[model samples]
Target: MPAASTGRRIRIRMSARAIDEPHRVASQLELLFDLTFVVAIAAVTAQFAHDSAEGHGLAGLVPFLQVFFAIWWAWMNFTWFASAYDTDDVVYRLLTMVQMGGVLVLAAGVPAAADHSDYRAVTFGYLIMRIGLVAQWLRAGADDAASRRTALRYAAGITFVQAGWVLRLVVSETGALPPSAQVPFFAALYVLELAVPRWAERTRPTNWHPHHIAERYGLFTIILLGESVLATSRGVEGVLGAAGAGSPLVVIAVSGLVLLFALWWLYFLAPAGDGLSDRRHRSYLWGYGHYGIFAALAALGAGLEVAVEQTGHDIDASPLAICYAVAIPVGVFLMLVWMVNASLLAKPVMRPAVILGCVTVILLLPLAAPQLGVAAVVAAIAASCVLLVILTIAPWTRRLQDGCPKP
Candidate 1:
């Protein structure tokens, strides 16, 4: 039966029930939804790079992490929820548009958020997204009888956490809380937000398609990596306009591209979609843990931008700063990817300790000689990229040597 019987069309179409399709690829609406995130990611990264270029050094990272976590968490909530219940009808599309608007508001606030002050726009944007999410959960409850209770719990939990966010915003605006109090307050709220879905899932698990969720994550990762590529190009362009494609700038640009490519290859070496399907119980670990991975990748782009600044005649880029900007994110990304791979497999597929040892060697080279130039430091990291490729190839090489059928 139709959800409404009156002559006038119902605004709530009673669409967006659980999906039943197999072999699902992301729909056009999903891709369009991701475009908003691209804007958010670009804004956040631009802020980080600009700050680092202004010599804020590591002092800028905490604020970046906080803002990034909020942005990433909002995106994750929608991704998982949509994986299970995106009906793509009129109501669903409109709510998603509202969420997209929320993303733009959030992006607009990123620069101020990075300073850990001026958070009204950011908080309001986040509240809009949370309300949009609650609507989806409530719709789910109305649409699916079997999962109504679970959906209601989700709606309740999210609504409850959103109240905490609202409180934080009010306290920040009204001076009810000191600036120092803001960190702990927001941290507590973040913890509560993270715990909600876990709490809701305990009552009854929602039907999140592992494969679809994995693809969505992968797509987001690609967007971040693309941001890295863009940053690299922008940095190179800045240097090229001033330095005229000089040797150091050219080397730095090429090495940065190589590093970005290597990270891309490393990320796709394992079939994340298949792994998620195999170990559904570990989905939370796989899903939540990716926040770090995504953040690191995006930051690495900004780091490359910092390296570009080093090529300027006026900027005196510290060797340590340049090295840290690029190397730390690369190290963190490699480590997290290793952990994800290890956790996903029942047996050890590759020796993670060996990879760690190699990464450590790569990271330490820059530290060993703090006087090293930016291009040389970038080249060292680029050399590490070769090691990763070798590691990826070794397993296939051994299999062929042993006369095993090619996978």
Candidate 2:
């Protein structure tokens, strides 16, 4: 009887530990929640494409950046929460459902949220989502003392930042503040938002599953890539339909497809998860750096959609459009390379590759403006991609050789 009791205790302990694992098979409900983000991505991309095509592209950037940050921030908050305290109990799962509903409402408000008359509805929805996050953190703090303190810190920091957001929205709606002042105010709040995690980690470092965080990030990357492909397909189909079904536009579209695939390959070749698993100290750099990367990827897709719209049209595509399309992807690709090098290899050689790629794309911009056109611009992007692919593989080769026994 004693042996049986001991076995039961062991099973219970193991089960409890498994619940705390970050990558613990996310519940089916969590997966369903993630699906809503697909709509969010599509909505953001659509707004970007529409604004760019209508010559209001610059106007769209602020809203796009704001929306992107909000969505990314929400995801990051939940990822860390799940990493530490994914109970997978009925209560936990139900709270996740509530958050998922909040995301949908937030997404639905995107179109008008940018220029809402009051900004109250959008702010309220966003606040609700954030409140859900705070609740999770509070729960963690209550369940475990170490985690509880950490959770309390997170809740405090995040709640403080959300209050700032609400105030900014109110000021924006009221027009009591100058436009220039608004950005600086929000910028200061952003700095605080970023600093909070570092502060919390210092005081009471939360136990996060490195592998789980890595996998969750990987899934997000795949979602961004899938959006790119979807944009490419829609762009190509529309261009082909308009251009007599056998135009060079199809070629441009195919080239864009290949370029996206190559960029995706470049991202995954570095073995980021393996490197990060053992070096939890680098999590801050890795996590924050991805924000820019994700924005760039989404913007790249939007730019590509614009390129497709201009294909075979009499309206001469501006150098800026072509440059924007090429530059965004190159920038994203380089950022990924830099992050990996910084996090894993502790080298800066990737900087030169990025500089070279940027210079190449910029030099090609004028040439593409009114003469070389979309196809040529895309070819230049592909060339830059090829250069990056070569750079990505070279270090791995050297590492492998170094690992081998002396001859």
Candidate 3:
């Protein structure tokens, strides 16, 4: 019915979706749009793995964060805008496809950005995406009187920031900036990018459906997790081809699979949909916090790949550094999840003791690598994750010996 109706609805002018509309959900076009990100994420993960395998993991950290911010922010900006004003018309679809093309452009530039610190291609790709988005905002402003001011505000802010992004390259090329100022320049633009939506929504928040937004974020999480599974497979295969099936890589492979599964299970347990429905005003914190969550998950995929490489002696990185690669991202992910839930959930999603304990144990597990070896430590990390799942399970079934958990 929606497929048929979208064609009919094409004739109607764009307008804000009703906040109380029943059965609001992601459209087919949205799913297709999300599929493009798989390539973007896979490119970023592969580049990170390359950097780590070459023993540049520490130095690669800054570029990794910078490149990932581009990917996450692009996807999120489109998501919220669509939640409020998706028309699914001919022009709308074409503009979205244009943004999808920009994602590919950005994905193609990840290597140059990471390896050489050259961001020309990345900046150009981001410019393409923002141009398409600006057009969308313009259309929304012209067609929907209720949201016109906010839409125009979004359009102007995005345009101005994109100009800054383009100019950042020219300024860097002239060698006018001190070496220490590079990151701060980037960070200033980041603050402006984050501030755009906040400034726009102060007058009247767009009519985004809470459930729809939650579903979109959940889908993106699955995409990242799926990418990790693929990265782990590639690493395990490399080890297998070289060392045969008898290698400890088999143990690492199995443990990684379990770790991915357990993390996936834990992510969906947050009840984000209900909470967002109840506390709409806290949306920015809950929404923006996922940047850390998504970035950590993407980096974890790269880390898992490096862990396999280190285990197989294919990489020159220290064993402890390799282990920390996996452990650090895992810890960050755990902490972010807990913090996001604490901010949004009506009831505490999990006992903090369980989360903090698992994080402490997970981080320290790598210290045992000297005695237990990398495979054993990886398995221990996976086991600790499973333990977290077990403790948090059936929380409603009964109170624990620890007494009632914090709200």
Instruction: Please give the clash total of every predicted structure, in order.
Output: 0, 1, 0
TM-score: model 1 vs. ground truth: 0.93
lDDT of 3 by residue, 58-78 (tens): 889899999899999999999
- Which is better, 1 or 2, measured by lDDT? 1
Question: Scored by CA lDDT, what does every candidate get?
Answer: 0.81, 0.69, 0.88
Model 1 per-residue lDDT tens digits across residues 272-391:
777777888888888888999999999999989878767765554566777788988998898888788777766544467667886787678678536767788888898787787787
RMSD (Cα, Å) of model 3: 2.5
RMSD of 1: 3.3
Each candidate structure's TM-score, on Cα atoms with residue i matched to residue i, is 0.93, 0.85, 0.95
TM-score of the candidate numbered 3?
Answer: 0.95
Write out the backbone clash pairs for model 2: 141-148
Whole-model alpha-carbon lDDT for candidate 1: 0.81
